[model samples]
Target: MSDDPNRIKALGGGSLLIAWQLKDKNVLIVGGGEVASQRVESILTADAHITVLAPASGLHPRTKLFIELRGDRVTHRDRQFEGPSELDGMDMILTALDDNELSNAIVKMSRERRIPVNAADIPDLCDFYFGAQIRDGPLQIMISTNGNGPRMASIIKKRLQAGLSGLEGQAITKVGLLRNKLKQRAPGVGGLLGRERMKWMSQLCNQWEMEDFSSLDDSAMENVLDKGWERGKRVPKPSELGISRRSTTSKSFSTTSLLLPSIAFFTGAVTATLLLSYSGRR
Candidate 1:
């Protein structure tokens, strides 16, 4: 292998992050241990129909709890994984058996059936590895070391979650709603206009600092839509944006708030902006 970063990594040596919309998809798990329990929790997020093929006595307490709680979607077969017949109709397979022979048999059958499979602690044999994840409702961050450092990935995941706001999940939900409203109001089209519209929306998002969401500058947001938006690609300043907090009682003390052109200044900061634009054009 050449010493280029662009070099294609060998199989099981690379990671491409994606979310599976496994709602109603059949997922067969062949184990009763802790690793199997983890896989059960991970796939449940996608609302998959899960079947655990293990004797009831062997099941991890958590795995049994999951089946009990989500009896509508999750099932415990209380039987050993049979032949290739077990792989039939299964969309995805996750096996955490202590028996290497059984795990390998399932891997081969899964391959022959063209099913994606992941064997516990067996990176080279897995079609995918479950990374350490942080979920903020619709926003999910998965940290992976390409199956090399699960422990490190978990540490990083915890650190990131600690730094993030508790309201981040709710904020994402609000932003998604806002996005939907914008799509309806502006109605994006194709070609140059479409690209420009997309850029404008992106700039709109960029204009909102983290503090903006916490103590949202409602008037400034309106002014950006009303005044600043006509200009393409230029992210407007706080002074130019006419910042005002939605709350009167509590507000974030920030440099941008200090810089906001006051009502005695430029609440209609557009006037100053228009003058600037006119002068520059001349």
Candidate 2:
């Protein structure tokens, strides 16, 4: 393990930071204790198809309740994890067992199968961590300290949540509706390209003052969106709107005005559409 707090190199020495969409994906979880319950709760919102391999009698009450509430979304094998065979078709594996030997064994098995695995409280054996997350409807902010300082991540997430307004969520919803409407009404508009759309959306979010959606009723919001789209159609270059193309193309855009409304609305809608497309897979 490296001494650097921001980096966690797993057993096979691979390091990468990524967000996996587990919707309708097969996930195998070992153990039924408190830690496992916590992992389950964290991923429940992801809509993953989960199967737990643990002794039925040893399952935690909370875990049982979660399975019951979710109905068919989750299933239990009612037996202890045997070996790598349980991971044959799994997209990912998670272990929350106190037994280090068993967890290590599972990690080894997962590695041989090229499956990503997360071992609770065992950063050295984990491929990823369930970092703190702040979700406001279609808006989501994830805070990660690599595999260290989870408590600090939670604290920062809370602080961010405190500074965020509920109207931001409503703004995201409104923007999403407007984007969909625009796509339907003007499918061939050049302003709808990735970079152009981002530039225009960012400008619109700033111009409309997305901090409060209550200020604009449905009609007013539509009118604003119409005007923004008109501006987008007219502005051949981002400089025309006082925005640089580099700003729109950067990996992380500036959050000076409305705080990620443009990027969040675009990415969130794509994610939602993908989830809906995969919903029927399982």
Candidate 3:
């Protein structure tokens, strides 16, 4: 390998970007300001149980509404933070207080207690920084600058959005459904049939290209699963199945594709079901 100064060396002393699995986990937010509310939205999507610990007078209007509406997932303390006892048994901590001294105190106490903490707008004291994300159905492209440049990450996210396929999410949805059907169709011993299913799906995605996924009609899907596996034969393409290629720039799922439920949710600055729309040129 050529020695390049710009090469990725190590994660030493720098942040490692990760998708934290927070479902059903408990998280504590030390402040109820706007930034704290923003934190709630991000963590809320992870299906985590969140408690905003700040007096009622300090809560941002939007934050209050989220706590009120999403009561199933959120709750408020309605009082100012006290001390170390408040930080007990927390899986994670987020500080959005304007009080620097209090922020420092919480960060120090959290470090002592070994809980991961994120101090908003104070990168130096944070253990994690939220990154920008581009969501399309089951697909996500996460962008980050290791807590150094959030704005830059947003810029990259927008660029990716512009170039993404509008029907890509639909394609992914169809492909995922086909995978489930394939699993039910083939059930051998432990690793035996699983390998075959994975190999075929890989080949399908690799050979057909992304947009071609949307061209797979019901008949084509059946032919691929049935005849293709009959003689240990290869899966047929949409063209071979007598289907015409779809426009890469098309923004909607082809009428020929399976009917998918349109499910999504969006709120201020938080995208729960951001199956974003995009289309590429043919």
Q: Supply candidate 3's per-residue lDDT for 168.
A: 83
Top lDDT model: 3
Candidate 3, residues 91-158, lDDT tens digits: the string is 99999999989999999999999999988888889988888887677676789777668789888888
Give per-residue lDDT, candidate 2, residue 199: 71
Task: Give lDDT: candidate 2, residue 113.
Answer: 88
Top TM-score: which candidate number? 3
What tens-digit string does per-residue lDDT give for candidate 2 at 22-134?
Answer: 88898888998887887787677787988877898999999999888886788888998876688977998999998899999999999998999998888888878777887
1 or 3: which has the higher lDDT? 3
TM-score of each: 0.72, 0.70, 0.77
Q: Model 2: runs farther than 4 Å from truth?
A: 1-16, 189-198, 214-221, 226-282
lDDT over C-alpha atoms for residue 275 of model 3: 28
Cα miss at 237, model 2 (Å)? 22
**Candidate 2, after superposition: displacement of residue 49 in Å?**
0.3
Clashing pairs in 2: none
The per-model lDDT (C-alpha) reads 0.75, 0.73, 0.80
Q: Which stretches of candidate 1 lie over 4 Å from their true place?
A: 1-13, 188-193, 214-282
Worst 10 residues of 3 by lDDT: 273-282
- By summed lDDT, the worst window of 10 consecutive residues in model 2 runs over 243-252
Could you tell me the lDDT of residue 268 within candidate 1?
72
Number of the candidate with higher TM-score, 1 or 3: 3
